[model samples]
Target: MALPSADQTGNMAEMEMQWAVKAMHHAETYMQLLKAVGGKNFKLTPIDDELYSDFKRNFPDLNIAVLNDDDFKTDMAKAKWREFINKYENRVTDFNFGSLLRIDCTGDYSEDNTMFVMRTQFYCIEIARNKEGLNDSHHS
Candidate 1:
């Protein structure tokens, strides 16, 4: 198949950017809603112990345990992660706007703990967390 032309690629990038912006807006809304119900002190835990262990069991290299390890906390580690994650590029479709991944469920929010990643990955990690009631809104 022929590669997309420059115009096509540019249009796609523009669409992706718009989608990402909208996604970020929705995330803000979610944050507000969760805070209203769960309290201003609320923070979404990425996953519970069982899920975390399962995630590590399935993809040991991407486990949360290694997140702060010296070998995985450097620029080279980030690059390595990108390279490792790219291996799944063909499996994902219906791209979502980039979403944030927070390292700690507690403490003040900052760029230090948050990682922006593709919508699919955010959904993959968060869907389970949500399903498990990590992000349940208690206001109702």
Candidate 2:
């Protein structure tokens, strides 16, 4: 096997960086859509409602209604999340692949309130978070 030339390696790194930027842009766009629709008060489209139901069914033990739920920190949650990610691996667009997901919609869009999560997982949580009562604390 031959080693990649320095220029080739540099190009690969640059391409990866561009992809990261694009992903961040997409995330920002998603946030904008959420805000435009009224953030936590936004009514989820039917597709999002179905996804939310699936999330509830799959992770029944967790309080999905809680803002920035701490259940994700548990070992069981991690295992279930891995399974959840795998289940939707081929279905979700941009499928996470170690992408940062913003947890708190009202907070600054930074690493502090975000964590690496699968794309579907992001939708599930955000939809749940945007529910009327669940996210009122943040807005209030």
lDDT scores for all predictions? 0.50, 0.64
- Separately for all candidates shown, the number of backbone clashes (residues 3 or more apart, or on different chains) is 0, 0
lDDT of 2 at 86: 74
Q: List the residue pairs that clash in candidate 1.
A: none
At residue 32, candidate 1 shows an lDDT of 65
Q: 15-133 in candidate 1: lDDT tens per residue?
A: 88887677667566655665576533433333334433444454455533113444335688656645644644554443333666545433223568666665544544544444445
My TM-score estimates for the predictions, one after another, are: 0.42, 0.64
As for candidate 2, its clashing pairs are none
**Candidate 2: regions farther than 4 A off:** 1-12, 40-46, 61-76, 96-98, 132-140
